[model samples]
Structure formats: C-alpha cells, structure tokens
Target: MNVVHILAALSEPTRLTAIHIIWDGGEHCVCELMERLNATQSRMSRHMGVLKAAGLVVDRRDAQWVRYRRNPDLPQSAACIVDAVIAATDVAGEVAA
Candidate 1:
C-alpha cells in the first residue's frame, strides 16, 4: 500500500467520516453505508473510491451488493493514521467492541 496516498485520502473530513462508518460497523454494503452516513450513492461511492485507492479498504461481492471492510494489512503509515483518527474520535473502542 502507498502509505502517503492512504494518508492523503484520510486527510479529508468527509472521507474520515466514511472511514469511521466502515471501521465501526465492520463489513457493510453500500446501502448500509448510505443509511449510516445519510449520503447519496454517488457521494458514498466517491469516498469509497478514495479509500479503495488508498488500499485501506477492501470489497467483497455478494449478489448485487458490494460489501466493504477495512484492510488490516495496510502499510504502517496508513495504520497509524487510521489509529490516530479513531483515537481522536473516540471510535477505536467501537472497533474493539
């Protein structure tokens, strides 16, 4: 994973919100994300694209739905960046729980 690129992706507020939704809920479909984030598909997908490009998110095909999950094997910098984001939001406990 390109750590720099991943960190860049995560540097945006809306994308960070997307990460929080994905990381907190574990694997989730696009629709699930839409509901949780109250975002349009186009907007949600835009954020997902950034995460995918960063190699911080992975996808699975299940029927017509595409599910997304965190890529735990991400580069060190990406992991650290995510860790800090979660810590700042007090969302890391949701991850552990």
Candidate 2:
C-alpha cells in the first residue's frame, strides 16, 4: 500500500484511534470499538472503511459481529510507520491528559 494513502487514512483522529486500538494486536468487534471510541456504528464503520482501503487493516465476519485487526502481512515499512504514529499518538495523549 502507498504510504500516502496509509497516512491519509490515519490523518483523522477517529481513524487514528481505531488504528491504535487494532495495533494492540487482537481482533476487536465493531461494537467494542464504538464503545471505546464513543462513536456510533456508522461513524466507526466509515473510519474502518478508510483503514481497510488503505490496506492497514483487515476484517472478518464473526457471526453477527465484524471483527477487525491490523493486517499481519503489512510491509515492514508500513508497519514501522504505523508503529511510529501510534507512539506519537500515545505521547500526545499523555500530554493532553
């Protein structure tokens, strides 16, 4: 995936938060994401679409729930970029709180 596309997908706060959650290394249900981010189902789904299009994440249908996680096959460079963004966001979050 193009770095520009990935960066663009993560450029928004809601999307970034979603990425951060997924980066923690487990599949999360869409409903769980909505609760964590305080977002509606539609809003979470929209952000997830952006991330999916960027090839940073993948989803699977688990019965009634859709689960999402970081794409394990992501290129090394892309993974590094994601890690960097997460790190930066964590530091920024610490400062804000």
Candidate 3:
C-alpha cells in the first residue's frame, strides 16, 4: 500500500476510528458503524470508501448491507503503520481522558 495514500485516508478522525473498530477483528456492517460512531449513513459510507481506497479495508456485500474488515492482504510494512497509528491514538485518548 502507498504510505502517503494510507496516511491521507487516515487523516480524518472518523476514518481513523473506523479503522480502529475494523481492526478489532470482525466484519462490521455500515449500520453498526453508524450507530457506534454516531454518524449518518452517508457519512459512514464516505469514510469507509476512503479506507477502502487506501487499501486498509475490504468489504463484503451481505444482503443489503456492506460489512468491513481489515485487509488481510495488507503488507507487513503497511500493517505496522496502521498498528502504530491505532496505538498512538489509544494513548492520546487516554491522555485526553
């Protein structure tokens, strides 16, 4: 994955949080994310699109809903960047708390 593209996609807070939620190891549907993130359907879809374009996530069509999960094919280097970003965010959140 292109580091610049990935970083750019992750620049938004919603996209970053979406990545963290997807990384928690399950296929999350758009409706689920909308409720959890307090975002509208369009907003969640837009964020998911960014993550998809960045190659950070993969989606599956489940009936009327789209479910998202971490991209299993992501390279180790790119995955490391994702991990670091998530960890950094977690630390930052704790400090803010």
Candidate 4:
C-alpha cells in the first residue's frame, strides 16, 4: 500500500475513528457505524470509500447491510502505523475527556 495515500486517507478524524472501530470490533455494519460515529449514511460511506481505496479495509454486502473490516493482508509497516495512530488518538481522547 502507498503510505502517503493511506496516511492521507486516515488524516480525517471521522475516518480515523471508523478505522479504529473496525480494528477493535472486527466486521461492523454501516448502520452500526453511523450510530456510533454520529454520521449520516452517505458520510460514512464516503469515508469507507477512502479507507477501501487506501487498502486499509474491505467490505462485503450482507443482505441489505454493508459490513467492513480491516484488510487482513495489510503490510506490517502500514499496520504498525494504524496501530500507532489509534493508540495516540485514544490516549488523546481519554485526556481530553
């Protein structure tokens, strides 16, 4: 995966949170993400498109719903970066709260 592309895709807070939720919870439905992230369907889909384009996540149609999960074949370095970002953001969130 192109690090620059992946980094750019993850630069947004909503996108970053979506990744973290998928990373921590495994596959999740679009509706669930919408509720948890307080985003509209179209907004979540747009962000998910960015993640999919970055090779960081994948999705499949589950009847009427779309489920998303982290790409299992993600490069080690990219995975490390994602983990680091999640860790840093989680800490920052905790501190801010």
Pick the lDDT winner. Answer: 2
Question: On residues 1-97, what C-alpha lDDT tens digit does candidate 3 reach at each position?
Answer: 7999999987777888888889988999999999977899999999999999999999999998999999999999999999998887763353234
Q: In model 1, which regions exceed 4 Å deviation?
A: 89-97
Candidate 3 deviant stretches above 4 angstroms: 91-97
RMSD of every prediction: 5.1, 2.4, 2.5, 2.5
Clash pairs, candidate 2, are: none
Our model 4 lands, by Cα RMSD against the true structure, at: 2.5
Candidate 2, overall lDDT? 0.88
State each model's CA lDDT, in order.
Answer: 0.77, 0.88, 0.88, 0.87
Writing each residue's lDDT as its tens digit, candidate 4 over 1-97 gives: 7989988987888888888889974889999989988899999999999999999999999998899998998999999998988877763363235
Residue 72 miss distance in model 4 (angstroms): 0.7
Total backbone collisions for each predicted model? 0, 0, 0, 0
- Model 3 residue pairs with clashes: none
* Model 2 CA deviation exceeding 4 Å by range: 90-97
lDDT of 2 by residue, 11-90 (tens): 88888888888998999999999998889998889999999999999999999878999999999999999999888776
**How should the candidates be ordered by TM-score, best one leading?**
3, 2, 4, 1
TM-score on alpha carbons, each prediction:
0.76, 0.90, 0.90, 0.89
